[model samples]
Target: MPSSFCYKVLVCFLLTYSVQYMGFGRVELNAQEGYIFENPYQKTEKQTDVTSFTIYFNQKSSQIPKSDEVRLQSVADFLNQNRNYEIYIEAHAVDGKNYKEDILISEKRSLEVERFLLIHFVEEGQIRRLFYGNSKSPNRTKAHAALNRRVEIRLQQKN
Candidate 1:
């Protein structure tokens, strides 16, 4: 009885904090799926995941794509409007080099994106960098390397 009660209390705490701190529009707890946080920033359309953006990079290149200029601008605008949210700049690269080289490449890309965000007036404190070169690739196959070489801008609520 005590163990079950403790678990219930813990689950409640998680649900509350997940919604409160993460700005989750809705939070659901289930034994099979665990905690699911719905997108809070979405206004008109319902999304399966959290509100975020992704920017892809060219092979061995860190320059922000011209086509993604609008997307980055939108991110900057959102951050400027919502001060309570911070962005996780997740960098990924294809596995074309040794482990260290892969990481370095990803780091360079992450830095470039950071600079872009900073120049756009997003608070320095609001940007966090996470570089995972090939290690976290969704697909490592040659054909999918292009998909791995990318940056994902994800939002997390300020604590």
Candidate 2:
């Protein structure tokens, strides 16, 4: 019985030692460095004052295309770093025959952007959405009309 108890104790010690040395679910300690845990999935915080990002939409479509999807990552990264910042999302739509339809489309676009940001862990209270519809467009050309269909994200630091 004593030999069996000694074996169990040795097994427990080995297990603890292996866990500590292999860095499995254990934090490493150092005199100068204090405590450190290596996590590959950890997101590195960025320091930046950049406060604006624009996401353009295709003609007559509220969905964000794959090409422009990457732009949201920068916004997410910025927001992640600046917890005290509030986001202002302004969505605009191109002028169509029906004014109300334009407004609805703009609102949908803004909501989509807001949803994306929220999914990236941004707080709901930090987001303010505004839809400009077709009223704010100054350009009459077809090429520029495409430019009007966009969602602009502006970040402001909380006081």
Candidate 3:
């Protein structure tokens, strides 16, 4: 074989192999946006089974009622019957607080509900969704924010 021909063949093979072996470039994940493909935060439907219940805070009550023992008991009964269901506790405050504090307040309210459920027999894993809505709007009256300081539970459909 001619040396030049051999050289050409070797060069072609090298170029082709290198191209196949090398990827385009480094890929970085950032928090600015959510990704579906490589999502570490994604919850499987099995893990996300949810149930929701709402509490209406009465503005005039002046004092928030002890976490609704009756309602929580009902939730406990439901959970006992339907072990497949998971509860999501959400807390919402009437939109009367300063904007900066709404998220914090809402989250606290949600956590409080979670605490009450925990005091009962609900498993922590069963409750996957937790959120707070500080009165963005008067969907529930400010007077009722305490009552509105409620928890919602949802059932995650099996995937």
Candidate 4:
């Protein structure tokens, strides 16, 4: 009888382990019932839209250079043509030990870009701003820092 109980326990353990590690199924929560189990390998539709632009900045400066103004103008033209899209602006700074100052500078960069977009007649509600202070940089080298100090503009279709 004891041997039979041990065999049952071992079988249960193996089944549970196989279901989890082998991705046999996944447990999900629902509004009606407390829980439900579904197939782990179910297929779902994925829609991807890759459209964005990057505007570079000089070291410790949030000013938009004259050369890059044309790029911003192009972006403004695109926005003017596509009224159904919204812009997402992300400003990043080089990795400096001064976290507070870096954050302020990044914020200023984003604001400057947003101001330019506004001046070009992009709707205020259509532009969103985000700032990252040296936190997202992959490398700490001077070149990489220069690359990191830039603003990214992403255009997304309005839902």
Candidate 5:
């Protein structure tokens, strides 16, 4: 009887491990420490849990740069499938506008991202955090500033 009980326990453990390996979990969208926008578009033949994708932006560019259209589409697609997932749009900007005071460009960048998502019909409440006015990292350069100006999306874990 003891040996039979041990066999049952071993079987249960193996089954649980198999389920976990088979992508039987929810995907979590997470933001990296600094670069928030990770690969917003990842194609998976089999469904697996992805934490989330991050979308980076530019601070100096007065308008949305030309490169983001495709990524935006990816985000839209993801939301369509995962409507229950919550999002956080973090906006950031360079500290100085004209070598003087802070212009709060980060706020503008974040808002723009929100607007884009809104245009696609992602409801406002699904977005939990509309963080703004994040300072530009000192390591960023003028040419690379746009990379810093972005809104990131992260999934809120369920309670």
Candidate 6:
């Protein structure tokens, strides 16, 4: 059995959630100091969380840097555990205005990443490679070229 105040809080919470979900209006709690209004609807623990590593590459180089070498083990472990998910390796390089070189380097970068996963015993069937090279970039400035020189790894569920 719940107390009257607890029951009232539950009712208020449900009403607030329902109204917010339907785009009606937001409920202002006007909470006081020392009182933390935590969201009860959200998960208290992370859901099936897998480590996300930011794998970066050197300028015009496909070799994985020493800083990111250690993180690849965690990625391999996760992929091995989640056989239903496929990992995507998207490789990119700095824009040198030479499409041929850019494409070649990017393809090499993706293969390098795939090689690491393969060495760790992750199934080859679970990997997808996409090489964008210099065709795609966040910016055209030399200062931001480092941002483009990298590989992005993503996981997707198998159909």
Top TM-score: which candidate number?
1
lDDT of 2 by residue, 8-125 (tens): 9999999999988798666776543221223346322332434776667877788876534555766777788888988899998885567788899999999998888889888888
Q: Which tens-of-lDDT digit does each residue in 1-159 have in candidate 3?
A: 699999999999999998876855667867532112323563212111224545545432212244444456667667767778777665565444565565665666666666766777777877655555654444554454555555455555333
Q: State the local distance difference test value for candidate 4.
A: 0.78
Cα distance off (Å), candidate 2, residue 39? 35
Model 1: lDDT equals: 0.81
lDDT by residue (tens digit), candidate 4, 1-159: 999999999999999988787884566855532222232463222212225767778888999876456667777877888888888999998745698878888999999999998999988878989998887766778757778888887889889
Question: How much lDDT does each candidate structure score?
Answer: 0.81, 0.77, 0.56, 0.78, 0.58, 0.77
| Candidate topping lDDT | 1
Residue lDDT tens for model 6, 3-111: 9889999999999998879885667868543222234552223223344434667777888875455566667898899999888888888745588888999999999
Worst 10 residues of 6 by lDDT: 42-51
lDDT of 5 at 112: 72
Q: C-alpha displacement of 10 in model 4, angstroms?
A: 99
Query: For model 1, what is the error of residue 107's alpha carbon versus the real structure, in angstroms, after optimal superposition?
Result: 0.6
TM-score of every candidate relative to the true structure: 0.66, 0.64, 0.50, 0.64, 0.51, 0.65
Candidate 5 runs further than 4 Å off? 1-59, 98-103, 132-147, 157-159
* RMSD score of candidate 1 (Å): 18.2
Candidate 4 clash pair list: none
Q: Write the per-residue lDDT of candidate 1 for residues 97-120, one digit (tens) a residue.
A: 677888988999999999998999
lDDT of 2: 0.77
Which ranges in model 3 have alpha carbons more than 4 Å from their true place?
1-52, 58-67, 135-149, 155-159
How many clashing residue pairs appear in each of the predictions shown? Answer: 0, 0, 19, 0, 15, 0
